[model samples]
Target: MRNQFVGKLVLVAAGIAVLLVLTPFAIVPAGHRGVLTTFGKPSPEVFDEGLHFRWPIAQSMHLVGVAIEKGEGEGDAASKDLQTVKTKVVINYHVRPDAVVAVYRDLGNQPGERIIVPAVHEAVKAVTARYTAEELISKRAIVRNDIVDALRERMARHGLVIDEFSIVSFNFSKTFDEAIEAKTTAEQLKMKAERDLQRIEVEAQQKIARAKAEAESLSLQRQQVTPELLRLRETENQAKAIEKWDGKLPATMAGGAVPFISLPAKQ
Candidate 1:
């Protein structure tokens, strides 16, 4: 019985020794930081990714990720034009490595839900309210910048760093979409009408130019029509008829006299 009691005591001692040896060491995964706590009180000492040492059963290590994390959220707000705007944004964020203890203490394990989501919603709403629906679509870059800036400011206070912000989409009411389509069609028709009017004006001007050119040509010809020129033209016609006369007159004449044919003088 004495030997059995000694053996049982030895086993209990071995189990406690094993527990002490195993609980002192911790392995922090990559992209994570170890947050130490004692008696439920968090410590500011941060541990990098690797094996770390702590007091057995007296201190504990909690891991908080410092790696980039993606978050997406959707929200609805009214634009400056009083139009309903549904916006979706994607955000990349991470807790600052050095601020993990404070983060763990203040924000607990779910800082994403506690801080990031609400910040995104508020930022989107605040920025969207400053722009009209058309401007939100047309000036998307500006809108995104505004939202990111707002988020950075809001999250920075809580040690959450903003890496990137993106706008996925913006949806509007069906009536507004239809109105935009109708406006586009009307503008297209107006543009086409203006183009046709310009074409018609160009054609009319070309016709006027052609008419003026023809009138100028006729005026030049009339100016050159002298009596001498007329006589010269008539003499040329008579000479051409004589060349084909065959040196014979018509068989029958309107008068009983022979045809008076003029011959060119010897030169």
Candidate 2:
């Protein structure tokens, strides 16, 4: 009985030892790289997603995400025209899978706060200083490109790759906004005045055309009158009076002579 009990104790000890030995193995989740460290020193080799083993108590594994992540940052700056400008930007980035060890050794787990945020702030201020406040609103695409280019150059050395970038907002001073509005309104009023002037000119030209047409008609009528036309008109009038006289002169006359419409001499 004692021998059997001793063998069972050995088996239990062996099982516990096996469990202890297995504790050094770790499973790196998907989309992440395992960073190994020995004696608080980061390892040069990065472990890909899967099971990896390290010497127990002498090493540790840290997972660094290689997946794309979003970061947002805002900064206040002065434009080239000395206008106050507030800018916000969003960035998409990821750690180079192969550079996880170096990144971990240098930047640690908070690369977004340590590297990306400051880069965004710096890039925004630098680019904004080159453009006027109005240009920042008008040339938005160009400004965003400038900021992205600057951030790419700054972040690449730190093992962060800029995948995408965008300008979220650009705010200006109240006085500047009011000035732009006033300018737009004034331009609109000027355009309306030009259109009204053109209409008035067209209407005046139309009136002049009508007056000239009436004068031409009157001149034409006057030119048609002549001595022959006047004689013909008088003879037609005398013939009409004779037709209505019933072939007899009036019984009474203003003078002692027969009262009759004198016929015009034949022309």
Candidate 3:
């Protein structure tokens, strides 16, 4: 009977040891934290990275890695110009270290993908709806910032923090895409035509200025040659001829030729 008692005591001690060993759980690997709960009620005390104890059967712990994670989602949304756009977005985020308890309490286990994807979709829609389809294509960085800001606000309420959010792809409806392309082409053509017209106009003004200068010069030349000016020019020419002539008496005076003297007439 003493041997039987000893055997029973050994069995009891081994079982106790096994229970003790199994009761305490390591929350996660290094760089992680555990959310503890008592009978499904979350406790405010968060367990850091290490082995920790909980009530063997009634209490439990959920481990959440506070490291950043990436998630993606796609959806159709309307732009500010009332055009439908399809967008794919990627988000990088991590559970806020201090908000781990709140995250586990509200979202429970498996919160990473479930909480992030929907929030990203909502934020994308909200921001996309405020911009035009053209703006979404050309100014994607701004759109990304808007989406990030919105996600930050929404995720904050759920005890999540967003590290970065980006728009991976933005697609437009076939009709809209064609229309935008055609519109852009037309605008470029119009600008080119306007430039050409301006160049032609400048050339025309230069020609007009040159023609006016020529006409003025011709008018000045004509004004300098009046009838009165012509008579004075003839008188000067006769005086130059007489001054150049050598004095010699003509035989016409001895042969009864009439003597004559030329004089300028009054104009």
Candidate 4:
């Protein structure tokens, strides 16, 4: 009976040894940082991705993702023109690996909620207020840059780093949308009318040019006609008339539309 009791004690010791050996080792996956805590208090040690070792039962490691993470936030603000502007922003960011413990202590695990969202909201509002509604739409890229710059500066204070910030959507009031539509239609019609007017003007100019060319050609022909040309025309007409005339002369020279032929005084 004593031999059996000794065997059971040895088995219990072996099980505890296995447990202790397994407890100290941890697997830190890729794109993650492990924050170590000893005696329920966070320690300064941060472990990179790989198998890690710590005090068996007295220490623990919490994994924090160091990879770029995506988040979306939205808010509404009044433009300089007093128009209500609604903005939605998408961001890609990650906590600074070296500052993981600081982040966990200060901003907690969800830094995006505590830090990023509020910063985006405030920055967007501050920038949006500087521009009128029309300007906001036109200068969207510039506003996005400003918001990103503001967010980067703001988030870095809490151990967060921004990779990219994009303004995904901007929403305005119905009045603004309707106004834009009306303005677009009017501008399109105005452009089409101007183009038509230009086409008509071009055609009129062409017609005037053709008329000028024809008038100039006729003037050149008139300038070349001299007295010599008139006399030559008269001689040509006489030749044609002689070619058709019979070999006889008209007697008495046609009195009262009828010619009285005299027989040459009977000789």
Best by lDDT: 1
> For model 4, what is the C-alpha lDDT against the true structure?
0.88
Q: How well does each candidate superpose onto the true structure, as a TM-score?
A: 0.76, 0.69, 0.63, 0.78
Of candidate 4, the 10-residue stretch with the lowest lDDT total is 252-261
Any runs in candidate 2 off by more than 4 Å, and if so which?
Answer: 1-22, 198-267
Clash number by candidate, in order = 0, 0, 1, 0
Off by over 4 Å in 3: 1-30, 36-42, 50-61, 80-82, 130-132, 138-142, 213-267
TM-score of 4: 0.78
RMSD of each: 7.2, 8.8, 11.2, 7.3
Best by TM-score: 4
List where candidate 1 sits over 4 angstroms from the true fold. Answer: 1-21, 225-267
Encode model 3's per-residue lDDT on 36-137: one tens digit a residue.
Answer: 777788888878887786777677777877888788778998999999888987778888778888777667655566678787778888888888888998
How many residue-pair clashes does candidate 1 contain? Answer: 0
Residues 1-267, model 4: lDDT tens digits: 999999999999999988965687888899999998887789888889999888877887888889999999788999999999889889999989998998877777889788877888899999999999988889989998888887887788888888888888889999999999999999999999999999999999999999999999999999999999999999999999999999886654545454754467755
lDDT of 1 by residue, 147-217 (tens): 99888877988889999889999999999999989988999999999999999999999999999999999
